[model samples]
Target chain A: MQAYRTLTRRELARYFLTSTGYIIIAAVTFLIGFSFVVLLLKLQQDSTLMPVTELFYITPFFWLILLLAPPVITMRLFALEKFSGTFETLMTTPVSDLQVVLAKFTAALIFYVVMWLPLLGCVLIVRHYTSDPAALDAGALGTTFLGIVLLGCLFISLGCCASALTRSQGVAAMLSLMLSVSLFLLSFLAKELPGTSSWQAQALGFFSLVEQMHDFARGIIDTRPMVLYLSLTAFFLFLTLRAVESRRWK
Target chain B: MRNGLMIQVANLTKRYAGHTAVSNISFTVERGEIVGLLGPNGAGKSTTMRILACFLPGTSGTVRIAGLDVFHQSDEVRRRIGYMPENNPLHLDMRVREYLKFRARLKGLSRKQSRGRGDIVMEQCGITDVSRRIIGQLSKGYRQRVGLADALVNEPELLILDEPTIGLDPNQIRSVRQLIKGLAGNHTVLISTHILPEAEMTCNRMVIMYEGRIMAAGTSENLQRLMSNTNQVIAEIAAPLADLNECWAQTAEIQQFDVSPAEGEYFRCALTARNGLDLRPIVYSLARERGWYLRELTLTRYSLEDIYVHVTRPDEEKEEGA
Candidate 1:
């Protein structure tokens, strides 16, 4: 437990000390703010009723940007160390590979949370402008936040696994970006294909993180998406650990 | 299993794609001893060092460091051993003190303990002045010192330094040598270097490796003594080449002599003398008897370079033959 804490703290310190974390936060905040402004203006022009509903409707588009941003933030977590020769130093230390992977994953998760905080202004603006503010679905908002956190965790773990696959940060980032974008598009492709409704739903569901996003958006706190997100996160995290361990044999 | 041995390896071999990088090799390092792993480029010294550090796993054989099996209990082995790689890859953006503390924490030290250990290691490695400076801005010597500090931050029982003094000036090299010498009784250090004189000055014992195998292992004196048979004597005389060759031939102890042209009317003869024989006195007396002007007569002792060359020469010949 002490080793885990120490590793996590050091990993966090490393993230903040470098410009990578700051740049990521600044980029994510600016995009979220821009999307919020665009949504507000569109709602003013098109909606006759509540702007909050429109804001919630448009927020899924932000996941496109969210999907693209995390690879930039997390792809260098282990890849930079491997390229810069610090991996040898880390490997020679007493810590296990699992500790190193978890610490890195947790640190990136924390940074993701901090990045998400600045975008809360969008929610605040929606609540302020709504006439029936009490009618706002607090449960849906909470579930969306949970879903966003889970998605972030999944993306971060995938990025970590990609980083561990190679020593080049650019290559890692490219691979991670491709993988994340492919998964994002997989659900849409599944929806268009003709099949039995249940099979189609399952196929689309596997690709659509947004299907899980929909449950959260509708104030339905379903356990299935939560399980899916947690399982995917664990699988990628395990791959990262295995990638690090394989270096010894190489 | 020896009582005083700090590290022991038996038939350690590491192969990649069926090509052996480190062949079957074995040696033991005693506690509190400074040993040098001397080899040329691509000699598998780095591979052997990595195996001992547990950074690279050997394909076969056993490595025991401080009584712990390297493969089975690598975490425990890593705790007891510190490794400085050939290329000192450090986080250039980090301050020296912060980097040290980070390494301490990674080695599982507590906050207070990490701070204390970082302080002591910084002082010991003589990087206290640049503790606050970013590592990228520091000089090469200072960077190397910072690397050493990180390696020592865990208070490891064994230190595995791979070409630690590769890029340092004479003065900095001297200071590092002094520091390693100062650590004589506390840390069992294994340093790899191709610089013969540096090894001669710093290491108590030496292991000469060539082509991924241990060619020789012992003290410097022992290596020198082992190659005593190849020792030669150079005699410079102002006499006829024929007379010099005949004179050398007459001596029973002299195996052969090659007379080469020197300055006008002077000849330099290289005489290969028998084992444990001193041909200087005989050459001097022969010059005097023939009324030859003897300019110089000296015995040439075998240096570390000679031993390395002689040891590896056969390997190369066999390679060519195959």
Candidate 2:
């Protein structure tokens, strides 16, 4: 337990000690803040009292912010260590491969959360603009944050796994970006595929993160999407551990 | 952890896709011994060190560190050993003290123990002044000190440093050697270095490796004796070659001489004297018999350099043959 804690703390400190960490935080914050402002402006120009709160929930900017967050934050987690030759010393330490993977996953998740804090400010702005305060729907905002946690874990896990597969941070980030974009595209495609409007569509919707986001933004807290995200997160984390352990073979 | 043999290996072999990094080889280190692994580049020293550190398992052999099998009991083996790999890789982003603290904790030290041990190791490595400085901003010498400090943080029973002084200046190399020498009685150190003087200066024993095999391992003097029983004597005479040859005769130990006549009035003669005989006095008497002017007659003893070349010579011949 102490070994794991030290590993986690070192992994967390790895971010702040380099320029890349601050760059990641700055880019994510700016993108999220800018998108939230645009979404606010888009809602204010409407004449029919188009709910500002609905705009917050429906905008692609929120999902875009979420999608862009993890790969940048998690790319150097394993890749830099391998490139800088620290991976050998790290492996020879008392900590196991599983601990190293989890520590990195946890650190990326923490950074991922900080990167998404700008969403809270957007939610507050939505609350202040409502004419009927009761129509604000705080429960939906809470579920949206819950959805963010699941999505962040799943995305960060994928990023760590990708980082483990390569020694170049740029390649790691690009690989994770491709995987994330493909998943997002697949989720959108699932809603449009033929013969998918029945029960099968609902079943396929579980794999569609966009559908889950839409449902969660509508104040629907389904246990099925949460379960799917958590399981996939675990699966990718296991893969990261395997990748880390594979260094011993050659 | 400190009770028995520090290391024991038998038939260790590491193979990559199409080649072997380490062939079938075996060696051991007793408790409280400082041994040097001397080899040229790609001679399998680093590969062998990595395997002993439990970073990789041997393809077909067994490695026991502190009496625990490296393959099955790696956690226990890791606890007993501190490994500073080749290039001395460190987290350059981290402050030296911060890195040491993290390493101490990872090595299973308690919070209080980590703090105290980190300080002790920093002082020992002469890097206490730079403890607050970031590793990347420091010179390569200081980074090597931080690496040494990291390896000593846990008070490991065995220390494996692969080419620890590889890229340091002469002053830094001296300090690192002194630091390693200071560790001789307490910790069993296995350092791999291609520098012959480092082995002669610090190691109690030397293991000369070539082509993934140990060509020789002993004290430096013992390995030197293994090179040859016959010593080469160079005799420089100002007298004429005909007069020197007329005085020279083949004795039991002294035989044929390879003579190179100099441009000036000197003949440079080299002789192979068998049984390590001192031929200078015999040559002096012969010169007096012919009244030849003996300018220089010196018998050279083999150093570690000569032994290294002699031991690694066969592979070079085979390579040329190929």
Candidate 1, pairs of clashing residues: none
Q: lDDT of all predictions, in order shown?
A: 0.85, 0.86
Give native contacts recovered, as a fraction, per prediction: 0.83, 0.88
Candidate 2 residues lying further than 4 Å off, grouped into runs, are A45-54, A129-131, A197-204, B1-3, B241-264, B274-282
Restricting to chain A, the TM-score for each candidate equals 0.90, 0.89
TM-score of each: 0.94, 0.93
Write one digit per residue (lDDT tens) for candidate 2, span B1-322. Answer: 5567889999999998799989998999988999999999999999999999989888999999888999899999999899999999998888899889989889899989999999999999999999999899999999998999999999999999999999999999999999999999899999999999999999989888998998998987788678657688888888866666655545555766777797588899888787777788888887787787778988877889988988898879998999
True contacts kept of 1: 0.83
lDDT (Cα, tens digit) per residue for candidate 1, span A68-164: 7779878888989988888888888888889889988998888888888865677776778878666466766776678778889889999999999
- Give the local distance difference test score of model 1: 0.85
Q: What TM-score, to 2 decimal places, does chain A of model 2 have?
A: 0.89
Against the correct fold, how does model 2 do in TM-score?
Answer: 0.93
Q: Per-residue lDDT of A14-123 in model 2, one digit per residue for the tens?
A: 77777777887778777767777777677567544434444565666677777777888888899999998899998898789998898889888887777677677766
For each candidate, the DockQ is 0.72, 0.76
